[model samples]
Target: MNNLPEDCIAKILSLTTPRDVCRLSAVSRIFSSAADSDDVWNHFLPSEFPAGFAAPEGLPTRKRLFFSLVDNPLLLLHDPPHLVSF
Candidate 1:
């Protein structure tokens, strides 16, 4: 797997679950870098995210953004009569 190109490795990792990716990172430095690649992590983010909406301030990379969303989901908006969820 280390012999493969980084893009190829990222593509393969992108198909895997987040838990699988974390385990794969333990295999080797190459896999660790591949697992942390934005190309791979971007697959875990919601498609609607950062599109019609903006991620809250301070979340840096795609990985951070993914975990942040999982840890604390965003509330789109709230009004007296209605509530919006994201």
Candidate 2:
């Protein structure tokens, strides 16, 4: 790892899948920020579901539902209706 250049490391990390990135982030400080960068996030969002894969109606599960909601203003409205106090 010491021999790896920073750019090459970034590129390699960038190509890593999100789950791996999340796991790596816990390994060190530098890795945590690198994994959370806009470059990584931007790459992640679009790659999560391939082009033309539409969100299923009503989203059958919470993970799917959250992904669809994260970038949507309309779904923000749904949160108020489903709020559960801890």
Candidate 3:
């Protein structure tokens, strides 16, 4: 019997890069469905950026954008499922 359950699997997946998960999804329907869930995307957000991010006006058409901030050297990464303005 497997020591890790579905929830554990999900948690492990949550920590992985989205690109890695997307590639894994293409291997089978089950992975595809789970990887596509909102939960996975939500889990990815905070870890990917600093707290209290506000998207700028006139956003680009690209699916992802790398932003440079004056205070932070690390580029800000944005994806779909647009973050609600605070």
- In candidate 2, where is summed lDDT lowest over 10 consecutive residues? 75-84
Using lDDT as the yardstick, the better of models 1 and 2 is: 1
lDDT by residue for model 3 (1-86), tens: 13445455555667888677668667555566566654555565546654444436542311122222222234444665344322
Superior candidate under lDDT, 1 versus 3:
1
Clashing pairs in 1: none
Report, for every candidate in turn, its global Cα lDDT versus the true structure: 0.75, 0.54, 0.50
The residue-by-residue lDDT of candidate 1 on 1-86, one tens digit each, is 67898888889999999999999989989888988897788899865444323445786567777787787776544243232446
- Each model's backbone clash number: 0, 0, 0
Look at candidate 2 and give me any clashing residue pairs.
none
Listed per candidate, the RMSD to the true structure in angstroms reads: 4.6, 10.9, 9.1
Clash pairs, model 3 backbone: none
Ranking the candidates on TM-score from highest down gives: 1, 2, 3
Using lDDT as the measure, the top candidate is: 1
Q: Candidate 2 — which residues are off by over 4 angstroms? A: 2-8, 47-86
